[model samples]
Target: MNQNAEYSAVNDAVRGQFLRRTWAMITPYWRSEEKGRAWLLLAALIGLSLFSVAISVWINHWYKDFYNALEKKDTAAFWQLIGYFGAIAAVAILGAVYRLYLTQMLTIRWRAWLTEKHFARWLADKNYYQLEQGGYTDNPDQRISEDLNNFTSNTLGLGLGLLRNIVSLVSFSIILWGVSGSIEVFGFTIPGYMFWCALVYAGIGSWITHLIGRRLIGLSNQQQRFEADLRFSMVRVRENAESIALYNGVPNENQRLSARFGKVWRNFWDIMKVSKRLTFFTAGYEQIAIIFPFIVAAPRYFAGKIELGELMQINSAFGNVQGNFSWFISAYADLASWRATSDRLLSFHQAMSENEQRAPAIDVRPEGERLVVNDLGMDLADGRHLLTDADMTVEPGQRVMLSGRSGSGKSTLLRAMGHLWPAGHGSIRLPAARYLFLPQKPYLPIGTLKAALSYPQADSVYPPERYAQVLETCRLPHLVGRLDEANHWQRMLSPGEQQRLAFARALLFAPQWLYMDEATSAMDEEDEATLYQALIDELPGLSIVSVGHRSSLKRFHGRHVRIEGGRLQEQLVS
Candidate 1:
């Protein structure tokens, strides 16, 4: 083997390792609790798959007799064979239809189960939050939705197809062997092992096809990654298109997109090059298969030992065997992408599971009416300290405000209380994890204003009258009429309107403890003060812990706290 051949061997090793890891990520979903139904569906699918192969066997025989009828010039036999052909074709079509129906059922059921399992895992224990916080993976949305769909589809299709082809190979090999007779070479008669010759021929063809097409697996993987990245970039552009265009950075964005798409272009070129070689070999392989059986049986025909029908049957068997061997060549690109998608989904799921299972540093206990922050400390992911030796207390029905500059440990402190800031040290004893946390950018899920206000709870939880009252009190009277108009409220509303809506949500939910982190900054000072007044009036017994910069916003809070100088303290604002 030369250097290129050695490189090819190395590629095989790397591809094998990649596939093993990818498979490890894929196989567990079936053996899960839903495995009963999943397995039943798959078993049915496989049986149909094998049965389809049985049908193909009948078709192979049909082809043999049909062609032989043509060669013998018997009009009656030819006409009768036409009827046989039609009958077999009808059976093949029906088998194909039911096989497709069963396979689709399996695919949809598997995808639904996998999607639910993955979604649950991703949503559990605030794993989605941490993954974004720690920067472990990109495009969780894509991973959960697009990548999972592809994984379900390509994996099942390829696996079932492989199974059918293997059976076809085994079934047809015997037929090819029986039809091929001995040949004379240089006066020393070679043993009649026509089947052995076909086997050797297919073996070499498969090996060469794989050698040529092996790189396509990784290439296809890279292509998917680049394509996903490009899509993510475009989505980002669309989401922030207003900001980009406001700054007149269209040229810059164009350049950025151009750069990202350039990677796609280059990688696609490499794929084309590999696919070109694969096509060349597979094409030649197919053409040779057309004549290979005839050539092998020609000697017997010249010797007046075989009929034309026998030769045709031999050719049909050769076709089936060769087709079985060449399956890898046909599906090489799909296999590559399927493996890539599996790796992505596996890593995503593994990362989500790891985060979900991570032990919380700050243990929250619902003890008395007061929250005790016991020796609470937090660290940056890089091992730098953010909040150190922190301790704070807030009693039930108390209003506490926290003031901190940008990059201070204020938000980290909130995360610590929530048991999400895992890279931290400390214990935060709260009443329960039932507090309402309102961040700076409120998340308004897509729906009616009433539903957005009543998130995590059904819209029916609040009567239409109270919902309207809260919106009017929060200075969002304009949206009072649009309560039933469904749309993407997150994109449609301004920051101030969204912040006010967050306040309305907090008011509606009535959590015992409400944590507001710059939640009302977007509204004007008067409206902000009014919304705080509304909350105090509507929820007099609600405990409020706020993070805010405005001095005008502190009158509603009885106690003030701060996370600064790497410590937590009472600010004592008068």
Candidate 2:
């Protein structure tokens, strides 16, 4: 697509469909098991807001008597009115405090649920890795942490604020209408005098505010993206601080970060310019609004048709009506931010769903108590075939070794078996899906050493003794004692040691089938042979399919499979 066409596509998506789609992302948590808590928080916050509105109305009534007493120069009456005002103020203050507390509580609950849901979907089907592989989801870290937090927080707060404002309008409109009695505007007496004035004033102001602030939505959206990009750059720098320092990359890092932050600077400048213009108009509108009611009621007061008290009461009522109607003005920035957050969350949700629909290469099914690959093929993401015309099988206790030249789809085959290779074509018939794939560089998840070894499984499933035995047998005796130590195990441990831990893990689980991709290559031949022997001795029924390029590995497997020139080399072990 052309640049103009792409811009048009994005513009249309933001305006037309994305917002409606955002609501779908919001419903699951509210309708799920957590619905009771969600509704409870919502009701409590809403009640507080409504109670605040009622307090405002009561104070409006108090305004009339207070001003009447003042106009009469009655000291005692004035003091009595002040006491009444103080009492009403206390309730309003309490209402405001509880309102804030409840809103924050609601925000965290909603954000927690949303964050977890996204985390699961993103990590569940290996969506995080696949999303990156396909270039499907953008800035997943941002989406999960910052964007999810912003989405739930702003959506709940802004949505509730909107609801409260609507209710306030309904409640205050009546009061305003009653205050402004019908009077002759142009030789005809109009019904509900205060209602007509309030309506006209609010309508004109709201239209002008919308017109002035319409550019804010796009600005806000751009600002958020720019900010996220800048923040991501900073986080990258932090993560790679050691490498950058070793290479003396301060100047380069500074330049790169400056470029990223420059986007933030430029976009913020645009927002600032627009904000300056908006502030002038909104501020002027507010200043004039304070006196507008009194101006409309002034003529009646001078005609001796209404007292000073009535004028003051009318002023307060009109202010309430105007306040309720001007919610858009009060929340314009938040609305803009919410729109941007909604756009991000909506895109994330859609990307996850689209990924679920995407076709993957590996087809998993059970076949007669043996792991089998029938016409199995592996391809790169771009449809370039990697492994072609491959076939293999392993029954229980049948240990097999896979050998292939580099770039011969060795790891790709293993990935396919694990159902992580979604880009390739062909079906893999497995004994069961519970099989584990131990990569040459095993993943040490962020937690205890025990948790790292028992990755993709709960630590509670294995006993301490089991964890201890595997660590010792795999030549990871150093880690055996530190099973409870928690850290980023991959970065913390040496490659050889990590590989050792991987084999140690294989010892703990009685996996029906195991796919080891160069899993023992990092270790010495003796250690490798010992670990393989330990597996055979400990779990004789364990079926193993391993990929490695070592002569020593031949003795460990009863069968050998090799791949060359994108096809499996059919040479069996004796």
Candidate 3:
């Protein structure tokens, strides 16, 4: 399908799902522990909105009396009407203030609730990891943070605005019908001519407005994506500043950022062009509408068929009715944005749901006393076999090393054994005990040195002395004094130091089974030997499975294996 066709399909699907899910998404919060506050706030908002509408109707009638008193030159009656206007204005202002405050309160609460809901789904069952690995969606961060905010606010704003307009339309249309009398056009006398005139006028404007601005929906969606891509590119630069600076990649990075921004810039120009055209038509439509009622009602007054008060009232009522009818025209831009945001959020939610429900390709279970693999097979995403019918087992407390040429799927095999690789079919039974997997580049969140060392666990899980001891044992004695200091430890520490920190983390956790995929590749032979020896000394029963090519690692493992031709071959290690 074409791009616009695909977008429309997705947009329709989202709208269908949104209608189905809106109640489901909102019902819970009202029925939740905070139901009392939720319902109370909702009722107050509704009450204030109804009161505001009532105020509009009252002022509509006030227009008639005030203008009649003015035309009659009655000072006392005019002052009385002036005092009445003050009362109406005060009540309208008070209702508006409280209505806005309540709307904001509900918006934030609803957004928070929905954000937590989406976050839970995104993080559950390693959905985040799978989404990233599969490249199933884009800019999930933008969807969760910004799109959700827009969704809640626009949903409320458009919904309440529609309700108010509909009520105003009905109330004013009735008043207009009663006041407009009749008009003779083409030998046909039409009753309630002003009401019909406003209806036809607004109907034509809405149709033309839609025709002129339909492209904006797609443009808005593209604009958001381009903006997000540009923002993500900058974030990547910030994250990899150290590496980029070392490579002197400022020019390259700038070019990449500029290209992404170029998309944003170009897409926004399309949006602006469309918006400018839409504004031209809508501005003319509204300006004409202002004079339309006066022209329609003036004929009756000039013929002395109605007083000035009645003519003014006719104009007021007609304006309200026409404005209500033009609601679609006024809100078209917001509708476009709202539709785009909903489409993104729905797609993100669908991706997570699909990932969660998909049948697992690898059957990894934690049931065996030893780590066992039986009739295991793995494939890359392109259907290329990496390993086939592989069977292996490691007894408790046994250390094994896997060696192979690059692209032999050694790391992929380790990932499958760790139950992370999804493109695999295997029955791998792991020991029902704590295990730790360390890759070459350990992840160190920016925080205190102590927290980085004890990551995937709280900093307080181990005693302070134990933390210091592990750091010193891992040859990181220099870091002992800086345990409590907070910094970007990943950038602050060298590659070797980060690997050492991973070993320190292993020591602190004391997992029974440890998997290392080139975990010590960054350190020299001497430092590697020292950390491996430290592990063996510190945790005597620790089962080590190391993937590396270094000859020095031979002394650390009891058994050695090689991956070749998609099979495991036992290698003799001295």
Candidate 4:
């Protein structure tokens, strides 16, 4: 096949895949446990939509009688038709209002359910971390937050609008066909001439519309990605504002941010150019449609073959039929946006699925009280060995210190033990008990001190007095009384303070097995020794494994293991 044919085939396949993925994303909600309420609300909303179409048909008929009464100068009939119009208008208005209100309600409920489901899937089995490590998807934060929102809202709005247009098309086409009377063309009757005119007009318009606006889908996708990239950059600046300010790096930061925003600006300009062209055609198409019906039906009216009322009704019915056929043209831009959102969401879901199904190179199982590593080997994502033939074991109550040169996989080994690093071959047997892993830099969620202290656990997990005591034991006595004070703790607290706070968490949770990768590096050796001694005293039988360069950490750990020549070796401590 030619290059263009190949591209077309690929595009068609992508579109088909998108539709199937979209259905998979949407069908679960309707078939879920909440299906009963979801279906009932959907049925009611659809009924309201259909009722509005019925009223439109009634009004189309009313046009004939009302205009005829005016033409005949019949005062009583005119007034009676006016009253009928008022009643029909009232019902139509009510139907429209209720339909919109119910649609919004359903949209929010669907969004909530989908958001929760995405959260569960993304967080399950550490899929979020794995996706980041694998580099399988970009800006998962945007996918979960922005793309999901757009998907739920646009899906409901566009899907229901399509349904309403289909109903209107059926209702109005029947009226138009009956009222338009057959046209005698070359001795053969061309029935439903008005309907045929609407179809042909709209068909040509839709074809041109697709030609003009086909690029918008790809552009919209790029626009969203660029916007998200810029936003993420800004967030990174805000998050590291203190560091940037300390280094006086405003100029460099600004240049980086501007570079990211440049992509957004350029893509938005392209979107604007395409949208302007699309709007020109769509607007002209709509404006001409207003008079097109009258121009087509005027001949019969002037010939006295049809009365003024019938002419007016034909115009109204024709507009409705034509508008139904022109749905794609009117909604082209929003459809592009919807397609882009669906594409991002589906890609994110597929990435998560891939990560979930990935076979781990390292197999971790909970077997006994001792943490064991048998013939452990670590490799980078590119298949470069970081560690080879390393083996070690830590029994209950043993304080083991992992000593290694920088970039010798000390931290990576800790990650492997935690089961977060999978690009390696090993059988690690962990203790069947609670365990905690602390990195060099502690994570303090932007919330209350109590919440941060009890992170990954509810505040109610421990009593207020216990939290205060743990804080005091970790040398953060000043923060004990401010348990409920909410702030960005990571920003407010210094590195040493954050490290101390992590110790407070360890003290609170008191896990049976604790792994620390330079967890106390920011602290003074005196304070680090004090905290380690306190942990050993308070949490009896705690199997503590720590990775650090400071010799001060030696006094805390009873066994010393060093990574030498890519293998683990136990050393006798003096």
Number of the top TM-score candidate: 4
Q: What is the C-alpha lDDT profile of model 4 across 1-574, one tens digit per residue? A: 3323433444565675778768989999999888999999999988988888889889999999999999999999999999999999898888889998999889888888988999999988888888877766778899888998899889988988899999999999999999998788799999989999999999999999999999999899878888888898999999999999999999999999899989899999999999999999999999999999899898889999999999999999999999999999999999999998887777677667768888888998889889899999999877889889778888898999999899889999988887799888878999999999889999999889999999979989999899989888888889978899999999999999999999999999989999999999999988898899889899998898999999888877889999987888898986
Per-candidate Cα RMSD to the true structure, in Å, reads 4.3, 3.2, 2.2, 3.0
Please tell me which model should have the higher TM-score, number 1 or number 2: 1
For residues 40-100, write the lDDT of model 3, one tens digit per residue. 9888888887788899999999999999999999999999999999999998999999999
Superposition TM-score, candidate 3 onto the true structure: 0.95
Q: Roughly what TM-score does model 4 have, to 2 decimal places?
A: 0.96
Which of the two candidates, 1 or 3, achieves a greater TM-score against the reference? 3
* Candidate 1 deviant stretches above 4 angstroms: 1-40, 184-192, 364-367
Which 10 residues in a row give candidate 4 its minimum summed lDDT?
1-10
| Local distance difference test values of all predictions, in order | 0.81, 0.80, 0.90, 0.89
Candidate 3: worst 10 consecutive residues by lDDT? 1-10
Clashing pairs in 4: none
TM-score of 2: 0.89
lDDT of 1 by residue, 224-310 (tens): 767888999998998887789889998999999999899999999999999888888888888988998788778888788877777
Q: Each prediction's TM-score against the native?
A: 0.92, 0.89, 0.95, 0.96
Which stretches in model 4 have alpha-carbon errors above 4 Å?
Answer: 1-13
Residue pairs of candidate 3 with colliding backbone atoms: none
Better of 2 and 3 by lDDT: 3
Predicted candidate 2 versus true structure: per-residue lDDT over 1-574, tens digit per residue: 3323433445676576675677777888889889998899888988888887788779888988988998999999999989988889888888899889988888888888887777888888788877777665457788789888888888878888788878878877887777777789679988778767777777888888888887887788777777887888898887677789999999999999899888889989988988888888889888988999988889889999888998999998888788777878878878888887776666666667778888665776565677778788787756788877777767777888888778878888877777778765568877854577888778888899889888778899998899988887888777777889888777777778988888777777667678888998778898888988888888767888888898988998888878888877767566
Evaluation by TM-score, superior candidate among 2 and 3: 3
